[model samples]
Target: MKLAYWMYAGPAHIGTLRIASSFKNVHAIMHAPLGDDYFNVMRSMLSRERNFTPVTTSVVDRNVLARGSQEKVVDNITRKDAEEHPDLIVLTPTCTSSILQEDLHNFVERAQLEAKSDVMLADVNHYRFNELQAADRTLHQIVQYYIEKARKKGELPEGKTEKPSVNIIGTSTLGFHNQHDCTELKRLMADLGIEVNTIIPEGASVSELKKMPRAWFNLVPYRELGLMAAVYLQEQFGTPYIDITPMGVVETARCIRKIQQVINEQGADVDYEDFINEQTLHVSQAAWFSRSIDCQNLTGKKAVVFGDNTHAAAVTKILAREMGIHVVWAGTYCKYDADWFREQVSEYCDEVLITDDHGEIGDAIARVEPSAIFGTQMERHVGKRLDIPCGVIASPIHVQNFPIGYKPFLGYEGTNQITDLIYNSFTLGMEDHLLEIFGGHDTKEVITKGISADSDLNWTKDGQAELNKIPGFVRGKVKRNTEKFARDRGFKEINAEVLYAAKEAVGA
Candidate 1:
């Protein structure tokens, strides 16, 4: 059996719901059993984040299952939310709801009529759909509902722009990266004197979303939202869009100038590199540090990546190009234009794995015997059993207090963090000891020689020599903190001791 995944396309999205729950003016009505909604809360709790925004959810039960109770269910929901008068009510049907072939649209329409509340419909087909679909469906429904509502109310949602602002789509749940990408885009748009309408599925509220049509344009940082919203807007509001994502500095620069061109053909092309450098101020320092540390040690370290399409592509790009690490197998539980990614990474590996199931990815990783892995909780277990070092890059991430747009592995600083984690995972005794004692200390050579002074400590010359073979360019500049354990810190620097520590760490 394979675990399923997908890339989302719309506003009534779980990703948007996930991020929006943290902001005001957001309401997501999960049409699932109570537990499904609770599971979301559980994920947030595990991540130690107050990320999921609380939305009124109507639990569809066995009784609702046995009979076609769409109207009754909608009535109950409307009454509950009508008291507070929610600006927008998101009607999300679960996998169970989808199974029953419930008329979710009709149900929402009835609910809207029954109460004065504006309604948005999200069709979450469980058997066939995953979080990505939920997000896509949600975004679509929210955008459509808002557009119509705005027309009826004669209220155009316009920002400061006298001409027209742009909406950043595909941000909520469509298998997109939240680690600073959104923040970077926001900053970029602001710098351009363009008031971004809102990040759909993240900052845009049901009320605010209703007026989405007024925005002159839409900007999708990722693909799913961009293409889908573009289609919907063309048919409905007739709003146009540009498929643009600001990833690396080059891409960011090209995109900024492209946007300028789209808005005004004669628009002055500004220096995009300057904008990027100003926004990601720490990028230079992080890059210098990452390049100085044990990045060389990570070379030929095989990797297996399983995440969203966009992130997987991003990870492999950085791993192969930036760190000189090898990605043996990479895949996304996401669907998109694989061609773009295929071209960039095809030469790096013999085979590129892309799928929406864990069994397939798990099997692939198991067979490849990679040195490290980057995925989620399940992949961590896979890496553990297979004797590989796995860094969690996807969800079931229980760390919530970590700020958004704070990918330690992104840009320069993030690159440094990635290198450190990788090096730390593979580091062995005496050489590891040397890295510790003198990597950052004032005495440098003296500290390292002193730490390795115990000739009878039983450190392997071969391992130390092999460690030296790693390229200096690949190593991060930041020194490993080894001063504490410099002088025979209780533990011996023998192969057996270090090996034991490594094994115990992963329970291998």
Candidate 2:
């Protein structure tokens, strides 16, 4: 594992906790040390969740380790059962606890016999999977288990609804605008004469999960999170699933037609052209904006995108194919999905990056010098350092990412939002040249000589005149660095010699 101060993802157990925390009436029982409970702080702080996150830590303190005792795990399970009375309780272990070689699954199964609730022991092999993979696997296992149970109970519905229905899978607590994505998807499906049977893993009850197979098909928007569950339902129960994430305008239109075609095969007639008319294009500004003269400002502008596989590929495609921006570099931290991401971005990017190291990504950004950046919050810092504007399109997000408005990065609304964000982020038209040409003449006093130099260090008239020769784009940076250097070195005022020395010192 990389020993970095920051990481793109948490450990595997945190992923399992995300699945357990997302749904209603489900609790997670974690076997870990006391410090491992810090995951709760992350959820509470980042999501600002009003209610307590549904997770109980079976604290394995030094005392328990010294005595080799595991009675605390059973006690915690019993306590959670008595207190929460959850319909489902998931059991998992942290990386440190995994080394104990304790049979966590067997223990949870036995505990279920004594408790009133059902328990699922998520057997996540930390050696093999990361956060997103673990989440996908755990959710899939729970979905299959509940589907099987419902089948045995004779609760599986026979015959489909009059209108075709689809279940939306893979929306979790920390997913990218998950609630808004679901809302947009429901709106789109409702417009197409299709019914939404249920949305899973977020605010879904165990009963809702059990009824997922009743839908005519499944819509797995996120490949990293819900594709496995959708594929399993299709293969095992013969329910069809459509794997497409409606990101940009073109992709969103394609996804709508694909869904229509799939349902049309099941005998529901749909005219895709009728839906993809001027009305649909009007729903997203990007469609018209791409052909407008304002878009000419973005022509040949380069962008570097780095994030999860889904957003990275989608943004790369939209930047190049839709908004007329050039994608000079595209990459992701999701290693498992690298091959698929590489294939998807082949037309835009010559090479695809697949790693979790922030330093490497920062270096890549420096090399590319993109006009705009689309990535996680870490990349935002890198862009700011390089004086490039960054629009966050993926996870490892900050509180600022969770906007209160209906900003989505999916469907028609998402295409609109993405295009607007890109337009606002990059330098438009000849603004930089205008600033450089007219910087020094109009703004004096404050702009040129607002503050008097100190007595000991003075700016000679020639040095001041020489500083004005620099372009406005770089003058501010040079001035700040020179001033900071003089302040640090006990210089009262800057002279010509000191100014040149400071310039050389700061690599200006």
Candidate 3:
């Protein structure tokens, strides 16, 4: 295995934990080392959860390994069932414990024989799947298990809701803006005279999974996590699902139309044209702002987009189609959804990258030098080093991305928030030109101090003087480019000649 300082997605067990912790009175028991228990701390810190993270680790120390792991696993499972009284206990294995090749399913069976609560093994191969895949599969597994159990007990419903209703799937704890997005979705549904039956896996009980068929249809907002469950529901119960993520004004209108069409197909009478028009006219300012002079300034401005599949594809379409920004390239780390992501963004981006390697993503950004970046936290670091303004659109994010304000990345309000993000993320060409000509006070300081202190190469006085002529906002990029150019050519120092040569080579 390779060492990764940062990863686009965590191991498979973390995904299982995310799903288990998302629900009420559902606990997860991970059979692994103590270090693997960090998920609880991360969830508590990032999500600011009021309650304790509903997960436990069956610590696999050297002593346990010398003996066997099954006893410890069974003990933890039974203890959690008794002490926590959870509705369901998800038993999973981490990358470390999977090497032991112990029978985790057998352990679950043993625990279930003694425990009051239901226990199931999250049967995902950590070697084959990553975080997003594991989360999606785990959710599907839980839904299937609960639904089948209810069917066996004759508790499953056989009818849809009397009114138009939908089940919002794939929202869970620690998701990117899930709380705000769910709120906006509810508001949108309420305004359109639609009823929300249930939002799955987030503040939901395991018992509610069997009642999911009550909704007229399902709204799977995220492609990464809920599409599998929706597909399963459609195949089994004939419940149609709308998987369109309404991130921009144009897509939001389309999503509304899709919802109306689905509800009408289910023999319900609902017209959403007035609701759409009203929302576009008053509730959402994105459509209006896109036509304004300020947005016009960004008509042809270039940007690079990279993140998870859902947000990356949605934001790319928004930038290219709605905001009139030129998306130089787009990509995602969700390789499982790469084909779908590429198809979604084909018209917008000429180039599409599908890899989890942050180094490759950083190289691409450096090569393209797009004015703005809409990506995850990794791209945020790349943007800082390259002096490109960036707005985070996906996970692998920092705490600041989870703002206190109502910043939803879905529905009508999301369009407004995204428009603001795009507008503020671009360093306007005109402003840079003016700053260059006016010679800002910070330019000299930046040129002298340089962008990165880790650089070993020295810069000549002549090179520093020449860099000061460039705009202060872009001086860091220029310096980095020059240093890279010099380093490539085996130059010990960056001088005036080296700077000019680097500029010409980069077509700056």
Candidate 4:
């Protein structure tokens, strides 16, 4: 494996734990070492849950491994079942425990026979899958299990169809702005006369999961988490799903139209034209502000975006196509969806860097030197090192990313938030104008004259003019380097030849 300071996604078993902790009356039993249960911090600390997270670890310590046994798995499962009385118990092996060749399915079956709560084994192949894929596969398996249970109960031969309603299938624990996105989407759908049947893995119960097939369609917004489960529903229960992640004004409008089209296909007489118009006209101030002269100064400015697939694609679209910003660099750490990301951002991105390593991203940032950066916490650190402005837009984030305010990055409201973030991240208005006019705080001649007046270096007028041709951002650094070069040598003054010699010496 590769050594890295941070990871874009956790191990496969952590994905299963995320799904388990997201739901109510569901507990995850991890058969691994004591410290392997790091997901507890994400659920409790990141999500800021006051209640204890529903997860237990059957620590496989030296004593247990030396004895060639792991009786703690069953014991922990039984204890958690007795204490919590959860509706379901998800048993899984961690990345390290996968090497032990543990029969987790057999253990879950035995627990099912003994305990009142049902048991489901998340047989995640950690070597073949990662966090997003593992989470998707586990959720798909759980959905299949519930559908089979409904079939056994004679609910329907396959599944029952009902009125036009949508089941949101992507809200998970520690997702980027998940709770607010769910709330905004539900509000948008409700205003259009559509009812939300259930939102999976977020405040949803086992009973609600079984009712997933009753909805007219599924709303799978996130590209990383929920698309697999939606496809499973379509194959098993004839339920169609819409995969549209709304992030900016144009994308949010497209998502709304797609929802309307799906509802119409299901023989529903729904009209949201008035509501859409009203919301886009009055509620969406960001779109209106972009067209105004106040924001026109930001048009065609350069930006660099790096994040997960969903946010990266949406931000690229908004900045380049909608807001008239120039995208100097675009990339992501999500290698699973790299092809899709490239296809979506082909028009905007000149070069795409798809890897988990943050160093590559930092190199790209140094080369591009965009005015602003949109990325995660790691990119935030890189921007700080280079003195560039950055805003956190993706996951694997810090505690500050989880703000108490309702800052969603999903729909119309999210569009407003994005606009505000970009406005604040870059030099704007009179400040930008002044910096450009004054040569970034000091004119070239003034800086050179002041340096010569204070120091031993002397510059000819032509040399000073050539130095002034350099970009203002790096001009000061270049001048300092040139002075050091002259001082190091026996030269007492800096002319055009001296400046050119210094450039060669320092490899500027």
Candidate 5:
């Protein structure tokens, strides 16, 4: 395996932990090294979860490796079951533990005999799968395990609720705007005279999951996490599932109509056209904003989108079809879903890239030179380096992405949030001219700090003067690019000719 300074997704065990922690009364016991327990810290910090993360790490140090890990694993499992008394306990292994090839399934069997709680070993190959894939598989495994148990006991709910209801699947802990999206989805469903039957994994119990098939239909918004379970439910229970992620006006309307059609097919009445019209005309301002004069600046502006499958495709379609922005390229790091993502976005993007490597994504951004970038936190850093504006649209994000305010990215309200993000992400025409001519306060500070920094590569008076002539907003990027160029070419000092040559060579 190749080494990378940054990764788009974590190892397989993180996905398992995300699924386990998303549900109430569900605990995860990971047989891993000490350093591998950072998922708890990351979830606590990023998600701002007040309660303790429901995961226990069975530390597998050198001593444990020397002595077989089965005892420690069983001990931790039984202890968590006794103390937490969780309804379900998921046993997993980290990449390091997976290398040892221990009999984790046997450990689970041993623990199950002693523990009162239901113990299930997560079937995931750490070497073969990443976080998203592992999470999807783990969630499906958990659902199947519980649903089959319910079936054996003859406890599975048989009929749908009196009112049209849907189970919102695939929302879990640490997901990008999942809580807000669920809230928006509930609002949309209520507006359409539908009730939410159950929301899986996030705040739902194992018992609730058993009753998931009772809903008239299922809504799987995220492509990465919930589609597997939805597909299984459809195959087993003959329940239809809608996997549409309603991010833009057109898609939201389509999702509403799809939901309406499914409900009406199930013998429920729904006036979808009127509801759609009311939402478009009153509830959502995105349609109005797109047609307004304020959006003229973005009509033909170029943009690049790179994120997870759902957000990447959704944002690309919104920028291309709704706002009339030109999406130069659209891509996702979810290589497993690359074909589907490409098909979803082929009409909107000029090119589609599917790789987790930040280097390739950065290179694509530099080559295209899009005015705005809608990507992850990694792309935010890339944008800062290239002096391009970036709006983070997906996960692998910082704490700032999880805001306390009601910023949903799912229904009619989400359209407003997305449009605002797009409008603010681009450098408007008049604002750019003004900033270039009379530098803003932050721009002046950045330029001064960049020029005054003490670096090994010396800049001659002529080179410094030439660099100062660049626009303040992009002055730091130019300086950094020129310095990199000079350093690569073995130049001790940068003069006016060197600056010009570096500018041309690096396209700063």
Candidate 6:
């Protein structure tokens, strides 16, 4: 059996908190003294909200953490929450209370009664814990407790007079690194005449929480949250869900087919192949760009991937066959799907290294000595030490995927971006070689060895013959500035006393 762990589900665009906050029925009561790193964690995790102010809160002081300041914790717990008094109040802890072993469970219980709130409290603390487990525990607790209570009250969420829709679960926590994928998936689904009734931690509101029954099935590409959320949706609404990463041509089309099957069974006549065909154009554009022979010299590029398992799988598979890159080492710091990753690795690479932690990944990269790496921000530290260029793929993620859909990672444009960024890094290193060869000073000693401050400057006939060979990033900056150099002024084109005066004007 493939053992899958539950990764923490939220902290995604953190739009889940926002979605909850908007409902007036949601209050995020954090169980930590004010000294907790709320600002930094919130800053690092979510993008949409700055303060998380109206919806998010923590027990007010730092002293409460180590010393268990119950009085202060209770005082801070008093909430005049602006919504429908919240049918459910989610309690999460910061590192302080989590470490101090404070009685947050009782604190929440008493607070509910004292405040006379009709809401239920849930503990969602997952920091300093593994990702999937973090999200899994919280979600399982919520779903099971909700189900048991509803059974007692004879009010099951799925006991409904509903139509049909597919739920897109697992957004907030795990796959939150790159939201463009989710956005593109949504757009693609809509263009194909599919309705996504709920996208948990993103579009799924508490009001819609019970409406999850309306969803005939679940579509999850982010495996961690998908499996856990699928279990929840199945138990509560008896909804069966498919867990798959909607990446690559085959995987993407397969997902559409699975949803189409579910929809057809539910009586929705949709052309799944046509939808996949329409979407193939988006994926194909990137295939053409990335698989182009311009990179034939770079074919069989050796690479090591270390980051989220999902992202590692995606990049390694397509990158290997499409871009002709070879994956020598593959690993992950976050909890993820290894079986799925292994399947891709087996095809794309000769050897695949998998890990659930960072240290092991660093060790693997040092051993493999691959030419390039795609990794988490933390792994970049290791890459820099090893003199390798590592692009951040997962956590400590880069903000380059901004404005969502404007990033083409989902469709053809995304593949193009990948090819462009990777190719430019190496091909652009040729400038120095060209300059050293043509710009005089042969015999390898004067040119490649070292040039003194007093060394006279000279560009041979071959050098002057190639005046404007600069490319890309620094091209415009150098184009306008190069001629201003004294050495350029002394050339035959502008031979003047001003040339000598210009060189003397500044000691270069």
The C-alpha RMSD of each candidate to the native structure, in angstroms, is 10.3, 6.3, 2.7, 6.4, 3.6, 11.2
User: What ranges in model 3 sit over 4 Å off?
Assistant: 1-3, 428-457, 480-491, 497-508
Off by over 4 Å in 6: 1-25, 33-35, 40-67, 80-87, 116-128, 143-164, 173-178, 335-340, 356-360, 384-387, 401-405, 411-508
Native-referenced Cα lDDT, model 1: 0.55
* lDDT, model 6: 0.55
Cα displacement (Å) at residue 138, model 3: 0.7
Candidate 3 lDDT over 299-407, as tens digits, reads 9988999999999999999999988999989999998777899899989987999999887888788777788999999888877777777999999757776678899
TM-score-best of 1 and 3: 3
Question: Which stretch of 10 consecutive residues in model 3 shows the poorest summed lDDT?
Answer: 443-452
Error of 2 at 182 (Å): 1.5
Task: Flag the better candidate by TM-score, 3 or 5.
Answer: 3
lDDT of 1 by residue, 410-479 (tens): 3333444455555555453224346545564343222122111223443456434433433332111111
After the best TM-score superposition of candidate 4, give how far the Cα of residue 25 lies from its true spot, in angstroms.
0.7
lDDT (0-100) at residue 86 of candidate 6? 56
Name the candidate, 2 or 5, with the larger TM-score value: 5
Preferred candidate (lDDT higher): 4 or 5:
5
Best-matching candidate per TM-score: 3
What's the distance in Å from true for residue 262, model 1? 3.8
Alpha carbon deviation, residue 262, candidate 6 (Å): 2.9
lDDT of 6 by residue, 219-298 (tens): 77666554676787687567778775666565556666887787778777777776566556654555555546777777
TM-score, every prediction: 0.69, 0.86, 0.93, 0.85, 0.91, 0.71
* Residue 169, model 5, lDDT: 93
Model 6: what TM-score?
Answer: 0.71
